[model samples]
Target: MKSTISLLLAAVTSLVVGGIVVTTPAPASAASLTEVANFGDNPGGMRMHVYAPDSRPANPAIVVAMHGCGGSGPGFYSGSEFASAADRHGFVVIYPSAQQEAGFGKCFDTWSAAAKRRGGGSDPVSITSMVTYVQQRYGGDPNRVYATGSSSGGMMTNHLLALYPDVFKAGAAFMGVPFDCFANAADYPPGSSRCTGGGGANRTPQQWGDSVRQVYPGYTGPRPRVQLWHGTNDTLVPYALLQEAIEQWTDVFGLSQTPTSTDTPQTGWNRRRYADSSGTTRVEAYSVQGAGHSLPSAGMAARAVAFFGLDGTGTTTTTTTTTTTQPGTGACKVTSTVNAWNSGLTESITITNTGGTAVNGWALVFPLPSGQSITSGWNATYSPSSGQVTARDATYNAAIPPNGSIDIGFQASHDGTTAKPSSFTLNGLLCATT
Candidate 1:
């Protein structure tokens, strides 16, 4: 998506340049079987298989689920319990396989792009192309398309969000790569992998952070949202590092993130609440204080269903915990810089977490004046009404630790720069630029 770099409108226009707007998937009532389509070659000219739901109607929602390295759809399929849901919900469930790397069937070159290779070898694109094929065969909702994956697969989900903003409406990442988990030059290039720094010193790594700043919701009604889950005992991904990611996201959204005195400790779990200003999306760090590299049940599957407006049966618990009230800091300065293009501008925002503890699971709420409108954004979400503004947590910006700063940017449209809001209040608190 970061195909170009310019300050004016051209900069923002580059966001949607690589977006492949194919036909929507068929409705939920025609195709009722796991069908595979030939998506050309699989790196080595090998054809791939894609599973489609039966009874697919025109304009149906499509979800592409990827397996972790050395794992395939069958490996993680039954665990997610998605096939039955796809059949009942009328949505398409795609199971894409990873090519064997160095004789092992457990890898996707996520570090290639960030490592300065061609922005190719993109598994997300291959997955996207698969979605396009489905859309061409059966009309589906281009906006509601979703994604999910295991360890490496989950990292791919973040890669897709950074590289392809206009692709999905929401995502659910399991005990995989958290936001900003990868940062290194010479390891990742534009529109490629999300794990850069982790790729090592074998070569120069491209900056995924730059790509994260560049690619995101391209005026696609609103910024994409995500529900994230990770076990505290996740030996693979450190809990403290995950906390940093959550903090970064919350800072960008400028939401209040405070560690409450109350800590609910279960047998092997300690749950903390980081609520968004709107109180819809909650960021709960379920630390398996005693568990290890596994999910809190099939939380990934449950979250996926809940985010898609599907029946979240047997997933969500019966108990409803009261959301803690977060005190907001006074109004701060808000500065907006738009790289105009594609009938919108690239919005760069800086917000401060003035609350006592920190801000987590937050959102940015700002009124969009007439003549100027928000087409899309990244980090934070924007859903504007006539005058009132409503927005929430994006995939990346869901946590902000105390005194931490996060910059979230995206695309918007205005007749002129003067029409853009001079300042904005995130989650009901005003934040001005310094």
Candidate 2:
């Protein structure tokens, strides 16, 4: 792994963006989303939008999905897959919009003194009020409540987990800083704030943990589990903050600075889990190799729900079983072509839907040969990086018309052997290779 100093140096030499940037704008609000009025106190004056899936359980889980700077609750609701997951798995989603009345430009209040203190007035208090309303009105499962966000929203994820541990079970913060890292800096803009500019990276683990401890002094209740994600190449918020967050969270959980287990769960993703005494993971982190500030990447929302244990199975399955496959006749055909040189190769796979009807929302499963692993991909998202890989369609190319085809491929590295997948399956139906 590259050192934080080296990454900062590289960021300094490259073009950098201002503010906590959201690469994609939130789409229009989903039809299911309804704005709530008089739900709670108006200390922060933030807007609240809630999504209740058509088939929610009697006691459904509640997920707080926050947006980055310049992003709104409705936009986050429509752009993110959280509500879609809620539709599949019974849950209610709370989308809270930050007010620009405080001059934050739709960014959550992570810097204000009131925002950092437990039960103090501001966005945090307003959010808690919203959660309370959900629990009373929607019969939300308090034990299963979770929080997740990107950029500025990510910062609030940390703040919420820190100040309201009793309220939130677990949280996932993408490109966020340590709790209270922006404390008492109400005068500075987010882009130029000392903490946002990477000046708070030198704190010790205990010092960082103390920041969270100060939020609820003398209260020794169970701390919320946290999952931090940041790209190593992120420039808006320095990559070093991810480590600082790990240090703070691991210290708060009383785990060692060293991770209990570390591995690459997917291509370009390096994950570390800090388990408690009972072997339950308390803090987890993911560093995306070579990625920039653009995050909450494809499929991350599902992963966050899985982390929250709201996925019923408490885990994510990347492949499906093919029960409808015939030995010689299948509904799909695939052709894989590879261009290789030395130890690297780029392989393109074209999938043709041979069935009489259109194929929608597909996952193509194939196994990479030994010693080959994917580094990056396009037009699809590949999981596990190597071995048996499942390529899920990107939103734009998710459906294939009758007799139509879609192209997807990836770059990989090998041990001087360039081999293609032996076979392919589309949504569990075996596909003949051409």
lDDT of 2 by residue, 1-434 (tens): 23643454343222112222212223222437889988988699999999988787888889898877667888777555677668656889999998843233457888777887787899999999999999999999888788998777788899999999999999999888888887465533344567767665579999999988987888888888888999998867889889999999999999989777776655566788788777788888989877677666545665677788876656421122122222313478998999999989999999999988887687676758889999999999987788657788898998899999999999999997798876675654456677
Q: What is the lDDT for 164 in model 1?
A: 62
For model 1, the run of ten residues with the poorest summed lDDT: 15-24
lDDT of 1: 0.49
- lDDT by residue (tens digit), candidate 1, 331-425: 33445665666455666777666555666555454545556666666676665532334455665766676666677765666665435553354
Each model's TM-score, in the order given?
0.52, 0.71
Stretches of candidate 2 off by over 4 Å are: 1-31, 101-104, 186-188, 315-434
Which window of ten consecutive residues has the lowest lDDT sum in model 2? 15-24
Clashes of each: 70, 0
RMSD of 1: 23.0
